[model samples]
Target: MTKENMEEGVNQKNVESTQMKEEKKIDEEDTKEAEKVNLTKVTTFEELLEVVGTRGKWNVLTFLMCILVAFTSPLQTLSYQFLGATPDHWCQVTPLLEANWTHQQILDLAIPFSNSTGRPENCYMRDYDYTAAAALGYQTTMKDPSAVLRNSSSLIQCSVREFNLSQYISTVVTEWDLVCERRVLYSTTQAVMQGGKLFGFVLFAYLVDALGRRPVVLVCSAISIIAGFLAAASPNIEFYIVLKFIIAAVDAGQYLGIFVFVMETCASKYRAGAGTLIVIPWAVGYMVVPGIAYVIRPWKLLQVAYTVPALYTIIYFWLLPESPRWLIDQGRYQEAFKVISWVAKVNRKPLPADQVVLAAMENIYHQKAQGKEADSATKTFTSRLLNLLKQLLSLLLISELRVRTIIVFFCWFSASMVYYGIALNATNLSTDPYLYIFLGGLLEVPSYLLLWPALIYIGRKKSLVALYLFCGLCIFSVMGLMLTYPGEAEVAKVFFSQIGKMAVTAAFQLAWMYTAELFPTKFRSLAVGQASFCARIGSTSSPYINDLLGPYTVWAPSALFGSVSLVSAALAVLLPETRHCDLPESNDFFTKTKEAGAEGREQGVVDQDEGVLNPSFVSEAGETGSQIHPRKSDTH
Candidate 1:
């Protein structure tokens, strides 16, 4: 070994050692930078969720507020069944004749009894002068004793003079002369209210976005109470109908506003399941309506009774908290922090020290500042409304979302139509209407209970598809029984119909969950509002559709509802399975071509540490490709 060769070897070893040391120092610096990035990037509200215990005092309080607010929906909507109830009615006998004749004799003389049903035909009456007949010597007998009727006397529809409502103590149907030729008007009133609801949903969504959710509910509750009280004292059917529309419009806002607030405030882990349970109060409300109606019986008093509860909900204004998400979205960080602090205190959770929380909030403020900004120029109400509409329409032009949006809209429409159609028809049954409605509402509880586990286990798409098809089949079977056995199958028909109602109830809940999962955050509220609008349209038409087709044949509307549902079940198959999948956050996150292939993949991993990923987690790497995945909040 020469001296030069040994020196060369040592120099190379020294150089290698220096390079290794430099690399180690660089690696340590990178590690520290990564830690800093994570500490500052508090992208999701879920991180602070633990500090305010997930299910504790805050959640319990929120649940009560949500349930209380929801009770008005079924009360206002279904109370019409009792308010507009029609008992056996006939044409009013003139006062001149009634002075001498008994009630049975007056009815026997004026109304033409059907040999088939042994009851007077509701519309037709003998065109004889009952007053003149009584003036001369007349007495109604078991046989056709009237000389005018003994000869072939023609029948005529009742004039607008008056209606006999002796059988009914009181009902809007008889009071408004909404029987015989005007029977269709009774159903029309319900449809009009539903139309009002459709408009209200669109209007209130904007109000909620511009204002806060809490204030909108408070204002709506006040409006509903006033409208309802006035409606009970309506001078005529037209006035009552208009008031119903107004009450329905205001109540619709209350229903959805509280729903959004509840979803936003609930813990992320429990959100998907919690939404299913929210309908429990709505079901209970329906159940209570029948009992109230049975006790009150009269239409005017029943309406007043239903309206009184809205006054009770007014107290919730103090109890309900403004949604924390809305506060943060509006750049009110201090208010949001205060709410979080309150939640933590009520839950008895160990929150970080004041400095720690303040530091974390500071990070949140900075992150929000760096993110997207609402345009200052577009701050006006009109501009915001236009912007919201534009964003909603943009969803149609988006890639993968376009198909999903349309499909979900149809599913929502079908679900709502079938649900309300069945509900309204149950009132027309020959059996006890109140008991029937109560039983129907009772079934809703088990449906939601069954849906919870199904959503968690069998997955969303399969569960929805199964529910749609099962309900559709049950509905069609009821139609068949009405055609096949007609008389003997009454009990079986009702049983299957209730089953169908239960199935559709589950499908309706699943539809909301499925649609919410499909849209990105930017258009989530708009998308949901649009879907609800579509649903309202279907529900609006439901009463008239049932009524119009019912006279022709019960099977017509039944087949129509069943076929649409079956088609919806087929459509559900086309939707990408979203079980455990992250919700999308932006329009750009979706691919140009739809990925039906993705549905075949495992439901995807739910990272407890990071929270659920956006639906487009794998495709759009732009916003999501940063250090951490975006946290999927149920509010969006």
Candidate 2:
């Protein structure tokens, strides 16, 4: 062995060890710096609320906006009755029979009895010339038209109609003479409008996410105002129906845009309350509808009345502000800061003076600054669309989220089906449809009032389950009453039916807010829009279910609605309870935030990191759901 070689090797080993020590020291410093950054991140909505100040001037403005905007939706939607009411109609009796016989005698002598209704048929009449019969001194006594005709060939159908509108001043049915074969067209008019609503929910959802909430809302409001007025002046049924469809298309944006705006604007503590409260105006509008219809009594004038109120929405352009959270999410920090500053000024609150940003906010800002968002932003429309497709596919593709998504979708579907089913079919009840509708609207107030407390205490999942179960029970009771009493117990049937409607309305509102809370912010709008899209499907088909099944068996639609409600309630149990829980900001919410906290605590990660809590711990320790402790710089 050479002594010189051994010494050289030992020196080389020491040099290598020293180099490794220096690198390890540098890495530890970087880790500490990273931990410092984490300590400053804005992790939850509650922390954001701290910066914005909850329940201040900004909340009041957005709250008022929510109510005012929500009012326009139901008015535009349910105004069809006033615009298309079909008054009692009958065939025009020839002058020969008109002179000799009274109107009743003429109808009895000419029109056939309807097999389904046992009333005088509206279209067919005896073809024999009454003038010759009158000249021959034929009696003006009443007889069944079919009996007098003696053969099918002797009967004719009247093309024009005389409408007996003792109850109504005017209607589209009489103005256009849409009767007999055209009777079904009125329902089709309503159906087509619902179809338009179905499409609009999806369209506005995309626009809301792609564009911005404020602009889309204003654009839709303007369209609604214009379409509503044009519809009022529509010269014919076709024109009227087309305009109605346009109104329906724009109607969703007014409702959903404002709804999402309010949900996004309010602090976590007030989110549920805000969601339920916005529907009060809708209930008011629902109740107000029948009164307006009663007062106007003329279709065109009623249309005009419905159109006028929506004009106030234009003022929203000035009143409303872009959602700051959404802006920050989209990498538009300057705009977000501007909105926050405006809100601060209006709210009389001061912003954090230092250039310090929340750790979460900083991370997002850094990513955007590093061109993570820019590269995607620069991608073509096709690429963006494909990305959207990929995102949607992920909803069903991920096992954990897939179940929640599917169940929530069903909840939305059933909630919508029962809601619109009872709402639209209220016309067929024993009571005057106007009064019935008013009562239905009145019931919704208490329903929502009850929802606020129930959601806060009992929790969203349980409250929904209970509400849906109660709705199903109410419907089932109505069906039982109908079956037991058959054509008799009208009072009991109507009362229970209204109760069912109230429950369904509450369920619908819950589904809206709960579904929003279920998904992450990344695709919340798209998820809600998809849920609403399913809802529209249920709403669109409700009429057909009622009409088609109603004739075969009076209990069919009610049974169907009740059955679905019950199933949905059961499905709700499988969904993760989100009430009072932190809303996930990212797609890996349950894992990265919640599970990470648990894992970090187990692995002593929090202890090693000098007691800076993980995201979930931060959320739990803050004011309310998803709130996080603020950094020193944020105290200002």
Q: Worst ten-residue run, lDDT, model 2?
A: 604-613
lDDT for model 1 comes to: 0.73
Q: Compose the digit string of candidate 2's lDDT tens values, residues 11-75.
A: 99999999999999976775454344322556554465666567897779768866877776777
Report lDDT per candidate: 0.73, 0.73
lDDT of 1 by residue, 1-636 (tens): 999999999999999999999999976775454344332445445455545667898888778767766676888898777888777767766753556766567676777797755678777777776655666544433344555453466888775424445545788886788876787889878997888888887788667767878888889889899998998898998898898888888887887778777766765457667778888888899899899987887788888899887787877677777877667656677788788889877886555555566566666444444535456677689998887767557768766568878889899999999999888786333456787789888999999899987876666778889999999999999888878875456678789888999999999988876776666545566666678888889999898887777755766778888998999999887776555444443443343112322442233333322233443333234444222343333122
- Name the weakest run of 10 consecutive residues (lDDT summed) in model 1: 592-601
Which residue pairs collide, candidate 1? 582-615, 583-615
The C-alpha RMSD of each candidate to the native structure, in angstroms, is 14.4, 16.4
Q: How many pairs collide in each candidate, listed in order? A: 2, 8
Q: List the residue pairs that clash in candidate 2.
A: 40-358, 40-359, 41-358, 41-359, 41-360, 42-358, 42-359, 42-360
